[model samples]
Target: MPADFHRIASGRPAAGSTSFEAQVLPYLDAAYNLARWLARDDADAQDVVQEAMLRAFRYFDSFRGGDARVWLLAIVRNTFYSLRMKVPPDGMQETFDDDAHAVVDEQPTPEARMLIALDVGALQKALENLPHPLRETIVLRELEECSYKEIASITGQKIGTVMSRLARARERLRAELTRHSTEVRRHDVQ
Candidate 1:
């Protein structure tokens, strides 16, 4: 194990003694990924991740011995929510249209099917369009692969709530992907 990760596994550091790179740096990717999904913008996600790292380092003494990823993710979620409260609601809230997301079965060509499989941009756009609560649940559960208990702890919700949110989020994601696939096929045909 690398020295930085070693420190993190050892648990709570002595007061002002732990290096930020040692304890907090190990989980930066997870932090940034969660932040990115929550913030839905590169710049905002970076800002949120930076703030989360700072806050985590400052409060390193409070962390008990356990999964550092979960701890860091919890901080990131809290920071994003706090930031959300600070900003006025952007008037651009998008309502999901079941009609728009409906799947139309036009027999797609082989190339179109391949392109749809590789269309990461569309999947990301669909995720971005989801409501924050649903998006966050999906990101934590599917993207981060965190357990329901871990997600519950991070989001401060009960495990049942987390499971419910994830189910709803997955259904919505399926609908979004179907819509994107149909649109991509249509574009390819035209």
Candidate 2:
């Protein structure tokens, strides 16, 4: 048997009892994905996820019967922020260029449209450029398919704040994609 199987078997709670793996492990992918987007570094994301999991395990007893995914994600977000605060502030400076938000022309040729099909690298870079709050909102709503309520709960924000952040994130993402598409078309013409 696989090690995981043995662990599950040995750690199985009695009927009607909460099983840690059953509730928490199932959400590991979501947790890791969120961490990756927030941390923007594979190793750092892994560290965040591991720390979050340990913290979740340590606090498992306090978890009431509710959405385990939300509970776990809340822990992940908190862990990521805690780790973020510990890093030296000097290395974290990011200059926000106002011109990056300028609206670009939207004229799309057939060829340009064809070339615009899901450019993962460009999209990732655009997302990386977003502020962490906006990026996290987009990831939770679009990537994780979380509801606004869930996002608000996980992020510890008001529902209105979550809505505004998501709206701004989408608008920024649209602007980024448009800018990227224009650049790609110009490159093709060269």
Candidate 3:
């Protein structure tokens, strides 16, 4: 067996006494991915991930047996929202149409169709375009596949609020994805 596992599984220091990289580094990518998806920008995402990792390390002794993913996600979510609220708003908030979200929900799109034809790059860009609340909800619920309760706990919102944000996020994402698909097709044909 590898030396690192022997140390961690044996409840001893791994390799050195300085830090538990064996126990923590494995989850680093997951932390960064969740943060990036939530922040929707590389620079901000990296910042969140670094800060979260430091926080995690600081409180590592308190973590008992449970889902580390959720624990880490909660940290990322908190960090992202704290930073999000500090940014000055532009006028685009009016573009988020709650009625449009409701309409989209009443008529669900086929996932199979999206999976077959959707452009991955376009999907990434579309996600980046969404408002912070909508984007964060979608990232946690859909991309991260978090439960509604988990999302609520992370965001400190009611379950109903989590559901609503997720719905609106989906609607905006769908519209953006559809528009991107059309643009890509047009570009391809030209």
Q: Please provide, for model 1 over 104-136, each residue's C-alpha lDDT reduced to its tens digit, 9 standing for 90 to 100.
A: 446888766655545655676778778888899
Q: What is the lDDT of residue 121 in candidate 3?
A: 49
Error of 1 at 163 (Å): 0.8
lDDT of 2 by residue, 54-169 (tens): 78876777989799999999999999999889987543334333345333436877555444434655677788899889999999999999999999999999999999999999
Supply the TM-score for candidate 2: 0.77
Clashes of each: 0, 0, 0
Ranking by lDDT, best first? 2, 1, 3
Please give each candidate's TM-score: 0.74, 0.77, 0.63
Q: lDDT per model, in order? A: 0.77, 0.80, 0.67
Clashes in model 1: which pairs? none
Model 1, TM vs. native: 0.74
Q: What is residue 73's positional error in candidate 2, in angstroms? A: 0.6
Candidate 1 weakest ten by summed lDDT: 91-100
Residue range 75-148, candidate 3, lDDT tens digits? 77777666667765441122323232222223436654443334554566677777777887788887778899
Stretches off by above 4 angstroms in model 1 are 1-20, 91-118, 186-190
